[model samples]
Target chain A: MTHQDVVAQLIKLVEPYAEGRVAHITANTGLTGELALDSLKVMDLITDVEDHYEISVPLNTLADIKTVGDLASLIQKHVGNDA
Target chain B: MKENPRLLAVRAVRQELATLGIDPFGIQIDEILSPTEGLIQGRRTILAGTNNYLGLTFDPDCIAAARDALESAGTGTTGSRMANGSYAAHRELELDLARFYGKRDAIVFSTGYQANLGMISALAGPGDTVMIDADSHASIYDGCNLSGANTIRFRHNDPNDLAKRMGRLGAEASHALIVVEGVYSMLGDRAPLREFVEVKKAFGATLLVDEAHSMGVLGEKGRGLCEEMGVLGDIDYVVGTFSKSLGNTGGFCVGDSDEMEVLRYASRPYVFTASLPPATIAATRTALRKLAAADDLRLRIRENAARLHAGLAALGFRLGAPANAVVAVLAGEKVEALRFWHHLLKQGVYVNVMVPPATPGNESLLRCSVSAAHTPEQVDAICAAFASWPGARV
Candidate 1:
């Protein structure tokens, strides 16, 4: 899958968690800042992403995931990778 | 444009405690009358927030052992065990710990935090994964940071979540190191260890259980949840602390794995840190023997735990966890938790104010760690104090 396809899916998964702020989300939308997602909420979103893609996002990678684009890119890397 | 994250984090907690007019971080205790009583701010207070589960801190035998070692072993070890600090007593403690757990080997660290830090970092490396509980202690997280391993968190105490995450790893799960706690220190909940054991076996992963809170408090002989659940033989490593039930200072990792001996040379935390003081080692040795036979002390603490849990539940306060040695009353908002903590201190009942980051969720906790030394009267007093709070139900 292309990065755009991954971003499109992530936006849908992150929408419900972002609450009413979903309307303002975009590729550059910051997960922690504008959306104010706490650590628990971030984990929930990551779980959803992992489940949706059947991927394992390493915990170390979480530090670099600041925006929707960053996460979409991460998901894209593991989209079709094998064991 | 980069704001210091440290300052930002401090502001979040400081502003809340600032409103309460007290920090409660380092309140000096004028005197320690017993394991359950202390003088805080010149007021006689019931210390319900200590980790002295067996209440042997003031036991004459343990104290005498410490005093004897203080004279003979000359206070501190003065260097790291890898250097000049591995005394005969240190080796004896390791053997005692190994025999107690029925493990082939045991390695001691200067503190419980280092035990987790040393083992997790040494066992799992680059290209491997470490699956840990979502609510594990900071030491576990720090260890994962140093490991250069792919660290992932499963839902706290949820083995199914762990299985799902590990399954996603495909063949990578085989090299994963899973870390969990015996009794979670925050909410006082025990891990679903049996289910976790099944996950460990099915995935062919390494499992480490930190019995920091449950040691000397669970099982027939207080070997922790592993013994309590009949999974002691399945776990790869068992890490624990001497500060809690042992009423001393230090940490240890016991296992039958050959990697433990290799880790003995590789763990930087073990190689660089000063060894635990002689008094602490001597006191802990005495306490370990007492822990093995003190079924009465365990029963008393369990009863005390049940009383506190039941009393708070009856008060209509939102309880954080089930009956355990740690009874956490959910005070909710940060400001409110600080108020409740401050009020308890003023009422001569001192409990811990556990706030965010360390706590599992946003709900702040008035955490009470029950001690075997606490009298029935003291437990009643603790319950009464909660009832007296104006916002007890809120």
Candidate 2:
């Protein structure tokens, strides 16, 4: 998957759980400060992503997942497509 | 003083609860006389929220043992275990725990939290790695933090993910400690210990099983999940608590050989903190003996839990995980959860109102822990309360 594709999928996955404002979470949006996805929601989102993609996402990689763009990049590295 | 983030967060939490028409800090139960009863709002409330797994808190033997120690040893240790805290009872409980688990050594901590904090931090340091279940208790997470280890969380109860993560760790995997709970506190689901043992062995990672919620509730002799799974010899460390099943207040870590003994000298949580009170140690020793013979109590608690879970599931309430002792009623949103909690409380059933940050999946939950002392009528009352809740039909 390309970065754009992964970003799109993550955005779609996170839209329902994001409390209103993050419905339009862009690829460059910061997860905590920008999109307002707190730690619990982020963990829930990570679980969903793992289930959907059938991949294991390490908790240590959370440092790189600060932004939606960073998440997309990581997903691309794992799932082999950005989207 | 300028507004502080922590204080602001607390205020925000209060405001948020008020917005939802619920009090976040409501319902303080001042004095709990028995494991099954509490005084709340100047009224007697059924104590279903406590994890008194075996209901041995008020046992005559336990009480007498604690009393005897109180008379003999005075009050608190007044010093760390490394100093003046190593009483005869402390060493006795440690030896008794090691013998009970068939391990070479056991190290007891003042509290269950400290056991995890000390053991995990002592074993896994800055260069070492600690792989944990996503659903692991907060103590495990905090322990990892104190260790400054490279911490990674795998999916809950997913050995495949654990193995995959282990496979990815080229060299560090060998030294990693794969931590999991024998029985998860929230969902009351047992870890697939056999699968974990297999993957842990294949990856050459050490296994540490926290039996806090399972020590007296799982195995025949109440030795915990390791004994139940017949893999007691395989797990590197078995960490457990006297607070829940044992009906006392302390924690312990037992392991084969002298490795755990080293934790006594090395663990900062152990070395720096005051030891378990003499009365607590004495009561726990007595409780351990009772737990070993309290097969009937274990069976009753299990049966009660099963009945409650089945009844709640039948009532159409959304339940989390396959219930064992802990039955979690899933409330999707926080408001409905707080509302439902008040409804249950009004019905005279006291349960844990676990909200976000504490609950997994960002879910809100009403968690009930069944005890051997809870009569069938009480369980039925709990079930009936849920069954009668508006739109709560299964």
Per-residue alpha-carbon lDDT of model 1 for B255-357, expressed as tens digits?
9997777897789889999999888999999999999999999999999999998988988987777888999988888778888888898889999988765
lDDT of model 1, residue B123: 92
Assess each model's interface with DockQ, reporting 2 decimals per model: 0.63, 0.34
Clashes per candidate (backbone, < 3 Å): 0, 14
Question: How much is the lDDT of residue A39 in candidate 2?
Answer: 75
Model 1 segments more than 4 A misplaced: A15-23, B1-5, B392-394
Q: What TM-score against the true fold does each predicted structure earn?
A: 0.95, 0.90
Q: What lDDT tens digits, residue by residue, belong to model 2 across residues B116-208?
A: 998999998887889999889989988998888878778889999888777766777899999999988887788999999999899888999
